[model samples]
Target: MDRIDTSVAHPARRYNYWLGGKDNFAADRASADAIAAAWPSAPVAARENRRFLGRAVRFLAAEAGVRQFLDIGTGLPTAGNTHEVAQAIAPSARVVYVDNDPMVMVHARALLTSAPEGATAYLEADLRDPGHILAHPDLRATLDLTRPVGLMLVAVLHFVHGEGAALPIVRQLLDALPPGSYLVASNATKDFLPPQIAAVYDRMLTAGQTDIWPRTRSEFGALFDGLDLVEPGVVAAHEWRPDEPDPSLTPADVSVYAAAGRVP
Candidate 1:
């Protein structure tokens, strides 16, 4: 508890609040409200991103036959986690969850639950340091690098602000995996926002009032270079093989971009 800072608003806590979860503080709520003030459908986008995650996991476990998952930036425990989604299809599935948040480390017990035939492990690590995350003993113990693995970087990369920062980290992680592995990634984008709203977002971003770093479609697509993108190359969060139509939302509402690609 000493390491946890309640005065600051962290991305995971704010996301949990957006998802209508209770593991957040006043600061998180404030941050969420600030974002929502700019984009009124912020909560809808969060839920849509979660749904995209579930669909991507299902595609990997069921269609792609991936039995191992390395889910980075695994936020607060939700209904359909990587192991749960994969293990449902393959009981022998294994998962290694990595996150830098101390609160996530504290709630890792909820993430460690595994099917009797499967396994799950959690480690406190940052996405920016893929080397540490990949070389961590806990990660090595849970996942077999020799086999095809599903690398999940869902709804987390927007924090890596700058023109050419995130791609290098992504490339490094993908390089460590075998040829048959798959990469599932998504990031918040402002391409769908109207020019006026985008200007407001830009002002907030420049003033350091918001932490999310919105990227263009080309920037998001660059992360998948040297890999084979699955169907629907890159689309809005709710548009990627959606289980059902979300009539209440539109492309602008869910400004997050999502895609799944295979490492060749």
Candidate 2:
């Protein structure tokens, strides 16, 4: 547990706190509360993002017929993990989950159970080093690069600060997968937020109070430039083929855009 720092606020733990999970430290709770103090709808967006992940996985397994998945930036396991959602539809699906957090590894081993027919492998890796993630032994053992893969970058790209940093990383990972592969990505956006609220987020980001680097619609669209977008492309998180349609959630409620796209 030397790697697990209870005093710091990790994104996964902070997200878990936002989703009302009990696997968070006081630091995470404080960070979450800090965000919520300015943005009262933070939890709504968190729940919507989680729900979007499930819908994306189901689409990949049930409709796209993808049997392999590389879910990078996998936060602390809660309900409807990538493997669970995919394997439920395709019993023989194979998944390789990647995350940078050491604490996530501990919680994942206990919560992320796999189907007997399907297999799941966890790796400690960072999204910034897509090369290492794609070449990892555990990933190599779990996924077949020759076949199609579902590359899940959900709720993770925002951590990669600075302009044009995430695009190359995304492209590199996508290049490794076959033609039939798919990409499911979601990132927080300030497009829908009114100027006053957006300024609050901006000020927080500048003050080092928030780690998430919100992206513009054009910037996010650039991430999927070479791929063919799925239906209802690039909509709000809760708007992306929700399992149970929630009319109450407007674009401002879930300031995150979610979409799935095919490799070729």
Candidate 3:
């Protein structure tokens, strides 16, 4: 709790604000408002990304027969969290959430509840250090590394700046999992945004309040290299097996790319 810095805007908190959550501070709201002004569809894109998460988790648990999940960069707990979605399909499913935010850690209890047959755990770890997450006692105890696990990196990878930093971390995490494990990821992209809107976003990023690097479609797809992508391939978040396809949502409206891939 003491580690939480309410003075500056944080990614998770800003995301929460975008999602209409009440857990964020004034700094987060201000940043979110600024971004929304630049991109009117920002809030809608956030909701669509969350819906994509639910669909992916359901597919992994019900169709792929996966029983374990490791969700990194998990933001503040919301309505249909990974555990809830997975356990709804298989009550015995186990999920481990990873996030480095102290505020998220403060609200970890909300994410810890699990069905009697299933298990859930939260780890205070950063995405940059895969070793610490893999070796964490709580993660080891909650999930069986030998079995298939769902590695979820939804709406989180854009934070790691630099040209080649994000992919290696992704590969390292994927390598640690067994052959049958899966990788589910969604990242923000500038491919669909108009030049003026993209420039506004870039200007916000340049302020250094929080780092965000929106990738191109090809760059986002490269994160799933060597893994078999699920049907429909990589698409905009709202377009990925949507439960209820919104006629209004277009590529330009949803600026995030999402996909699920299997290790084998």
Cα RMSD, each candidate: 1.0, 0.9, 1.2
Tens digit of lDDT per residue, candidate 3, span 159-186? Answer: 8887667899999999899998999998
The digit string of per-residue lDDT tens for model 2 on 1-264 reads 698999989999999998889999999999989987777667888888899999999999999999999999899999889999998899899999899999998888888988999899999999999989988998998899999999999999999998777899999999999999999999988888888988898899999998888888888989999899999898998989877888777999889988889998
> Judged by lDDT against the true structure, how good is candidate 3?
0.89
> Which portions of model 2 show Cα errors greater than 4 Å?
none
Instruction: State each model's CA lDDT, in order.
Output: 0.91, 0.90, 0.89
Candidate 2 vs candidate 3, TM-score winner: 2
The better-scoring model by lDDT among 2 and 3 is 2
Colliding pairs, model 1: none
Lowest summed lDDT across 10 adjacent residues in model 2 is found at 36-45
What ranking of all candidate models by TM-score puts the best one first? 2, 1, 3
TM-score of each: 0.98, 0.98, 0.96
